[model samples]
Target: MSGPVYFVSGIDTGIGKTFATGYLAKLWSEHGKKVITQKLIQTGNVDISEDIQQHREIMGMGWFPEDMTKLTMPEIFTYPASPHLATKIDAREIDFQKIADATLQLAEKYDVVLLEGAGGLMVPLTTELLTIDYIAQKKFPVILVSSGRLGSINHTLLSLEALKIRGLPLYALAYNLNDESQDAIISKDTSEYLKTYLAQNFPNAQWIDIPVVQHKDPLMD
Candidate 1:
């Protein structure tokens, strides 16, 4: 398959990386591309991989030819924590070579691979391997998801700086994930502000706004 692997990471957890990954996959599939998603490690969910589940649910039906979750996320744990701590909780260890091999194998099977990372860029994949380390090793284009909420500037900028240090090309998207029904301290203008800021400061970097999906998306339902 054609190679267009996007390594999706967030400035922080719960910043819509998983949702954005699914949305991108759906878009590619709609354009008649064979799209697949990969999440190296999924935590918190005991029975299933929550990120891939949401991705498949949003991508709707028939997008995947077979059971894709097993191929995508080969490593998962029940603990709701970082990969290192989560594996520790499970009394196991994360084999870097194993993850690297699995990732390489998946890249050979699909037209576009959306590889979503857990937590933030700095989140440890193992004791020594950070999420960014994986991206750097694979050399995939980075898709940085940022929560368009208060204090997003600090978080997003910090992430951008790190990517720059690693010389990683990043496509940024700012969105509000989770329940928006409650009156929360969300910044309505943050998305636009972030786009403008990135344009002014890091002119080459791409920043986009993903429309917030309600709790029950009619399109997915």
Candidate 2:
């Protein structure tokens, strides 16, 4: 059977979606599962981002099957913008169907596939569809990666609401503490407040703490 879990979307761009995806993949790998990762619609790929390389290194030498990288990561774009904007600048279209197919193929082969979204949940993949819509269609349990920062509460709540409207299965909410000193109140109370609020509104969702670390280390603590 295919894997049962997939990371759906992050709260915003550069919110450690890759780091979290790598950490989750590493965790599964330690458990002796054939773990793989995919960066669907990777943008600003100059020579492969640090996040992709981190995943490969975490998999270790010779442990990664060739098909894992080849099948998983496709549609690398150079412009650091939304897929719609980036693809337009590059004179191409976002072939989301190809991404969906590739992810499914990897899931069919590997024990777990950590599919990372390009941007926020509502970021447009095409003219009509958003990233969260793709996740809902794929029917993957979502794990939202958020950060402890100013306006995080509103962003997280809006993202949660969008997912709810789409009727997606939100597995958990990971409030990553990337910015330790944003605003005193935000840095201190965002996680606790979100956890309590989500528990009340989305009872099925759990809150996980992902501490910010240097050198792209796993979320261990």
Candidate 3:
């Protein structure tokens, strides 16, 4: 399926979803595939989209200018919190149907559209809809990004279970090198455990350990 859309969701928040999406998108673009990225909703930034900007900077995405609000970032809330709470605090209502329409339009234009969700799969887009609900509705394959930390195993397993219950396709599992403060031994063990477990169970899913990239282009740094 050309121009496929993958919803890059995390087992939990702050799992490097933005970096992972940008890194993967850059690789696909380098291979001559026209890839575009979008952040479903953004909070914590008042002026510009720091997450989308980082994706563009890292991927050298110059197709859309900063003025293109709906393309790069469909929704924005000044409060740095969940989409539902943030939208409420900002006194704004989110029209999920409109958001879905915009996303489909972008997908029609590119070989791939990597969507970065605000937080976890269960993250509330509104009081009624969740991030996972949208992915399930769209039937988009999911790329779950988990932080390789002490409790990552339980978190990843739970996340996988949630996706399974929703009948969402688990396309890939990405382990981000978490903070060094986490016991490296536990992190190593967790990765090995998930590798074997996922392979034996979900044989079709790809298990990847993403390197910690410090900058946009590692060569430039």
Candidate 4:
């Protein structure tokens, strides 16, 4: 049997989706589960995906064999932009079948696969296909990365509504502590409000807190 693949997406760009994914992979692996992470479509790089490198750094593990083989980063575009625009700029189209095949290959080996998306749910992988549309197509449970930053409530709710409209299962809401609002008041309230909202709405989903940590000096006191 294949392992479960959790689609990790954020409310907006730079919302710590990469960090949340790495944290979860490390956490689950520490608990004895074989975990691996894959980038759906990497942009802004060539020959390697910087996001995958960050994930490995955050997880404190060296590169995996899949990374060297390009299985973890199946599709890479050279431009630093959304997949649709990046693909256009690079004069290439995303090979969805290759990505699916890679994911299947990883699933066959790992106990869990954390597939990280390029951006928010609304981000277009192609002009006609949104990131969330791909998630729906794969029928993967989502792990939405959110933070207590300002406007999170609105953005998070909108994302939830889109998932609900498509009948997608939310596996967890990974709250990114590292990206919280600077104002303590707003940050605390945002967390409280979202927790209550999540409990009342998606009772089965887990609330995962991705803590802030200095990746560079992890061993420093």
Candidate 5:
């Protein structure tokens, strides 16, 4: 077809987008599909932390189609803030054209490409454009990842609303259990509640529960 599946933005940052993307990539590769993972925009790259390196190693071990190092990981800002702010501090600007060009290039090379966004859905990459807006224009079915926490219900609902506003196709919604303490109470209950809400509000959205794991490799499953 056109290319591999694309992962879309979420309601907020630190919601395990990278972890979820790596897991999906590894899972697809295990199924014998040639896959590639792209950060799209990575910040706070200080000597390649374990998180970033793990993705590279997982893709390599899985025998993915292309070299992990060659994948598109642009907008390497020093600050771990939003892309716009991070770039501003360094007197740099994010070139949406360059990011788009790289993404399309990877789409041409791989059977399944896992594209990861920097932050939340409304996080701005440029003055005029948000990540979600760009992904909507691409018209790829989104695999939105959310957390199981106090405000997950609201966050998930708002995220879905943003997608609807942008007219993006949502493939699924993955409720990731990133925090263990929250699992027994907040995590479990919130997920159930969100599942019900999504069924009634966004019937087309598939709800998936990603089990809590100790390491990044768990995501590969």
Candidate 6:
């Protein structure tokens, strides 16, 4: 049987999505689950995916065979922008089939695959397709990455509404502790408000706390 693939997205860019994904992968692996991470589409790089590299560093497993074979990073663009703009600038369209095939390959061997997206849910993968649209098509449950930074409540709720509108399954909301606001009151209140909102709206969804850590790659200087 094929394993489940969870799409990891954030409320906004720089909200610690990559960190959350790596943390979850490491946590699940420690608890004895064969977990692997996949970058849905990597931007701002050529030949190698920095996000995937960071994930390995955080997981402390270096690189997997799949990563070496490019199965985990199927699509990469040269420009540091959303997929649509990056694809436009690179004069190439995203090969959706290749990505799907890669995910299928990873799911076949791993217990769970954490597929991380480029940015927020509404980020466009193409002129006609948004990130959330691809998630709906693949039917992958979401593990949204959020934090207690200022304006997080509005962003998180809006992201949640988009999922609700599409009837998507929210597997969990990964609260990143590394990106919290400097003001303690704001951070604490944001946490409580989001928790109550999740309880009322997505009652079955899990709340995962992603702790702060310094991920250093032993191989890198």
Q: Estimate each model's TM-score.
A: 0.85, 0.86, 0.90, 0.96, 0.84, 0.96
lDDT of 3: 0.79
Clashes of each: 0, 0, 1, 0, 1, 0
Per-residue lDDT value at 65 in model 5 = 38
Name the 10 consecutive residues with the lowest summed lDDT in model 5.
62-71
lDDT tens per residue, model 5, 79-195: 777777778876888776776776777788778777778778888877787878778777778888887767767877888888888788778887777632345787678777878
The positional error of residue 51 in candidate 2, measured at the CA in angstroms, is: 3.2
Which portions of model 3 miss their true places by more than 4 Å?
63-69, 178-182, 215-221
CA lDDT scores, all candidates in order: 0.74, 0.73, 0.79, 0.92, 0.70, 0.93
Which tens-of-lDDT digit does each residue in 1-221 have in candidate 3?
44789899988777778888887889889999988888888897786667887887778766474227566687778999999999999898986776677787788888888888988999998899888888888899999998667677887899899888988888899777633226778777878888988998678998766677665343211
Tell how far residue 135 is off in model 1, in angstroms.
Answer: 1.3
| Model 2 lDDT tens row, 93-170 | 877678777777777888887877888888987778888877877778888988777777888899988888888888
Model 6 clash pairs? none
TM-score, cand. 6 vs. native: 0.96
Q: Give me the displacement of residue 221 in model 1, in angstroms.
A: 18
Q: Summarize candidate 6's per-residue lDDT along 137-213 as a digit string, tens digits.
A: 99999999999999999999999999999999999999988888999999999999999999999999999998876
Pick the lDDT winner.
6
Q: Model 6: how far is 216 from its true place, Å?
A: 9.6
Estimate the TM-score for candidate 2.
0.86
Model 5 CA deviation exceeding 4 Å by range: 46-52, 58-70, 180-183, 216-221
Model 1: per-residue Cα lDDT at residue 112: 83
lDDT of 1 at 73: 66
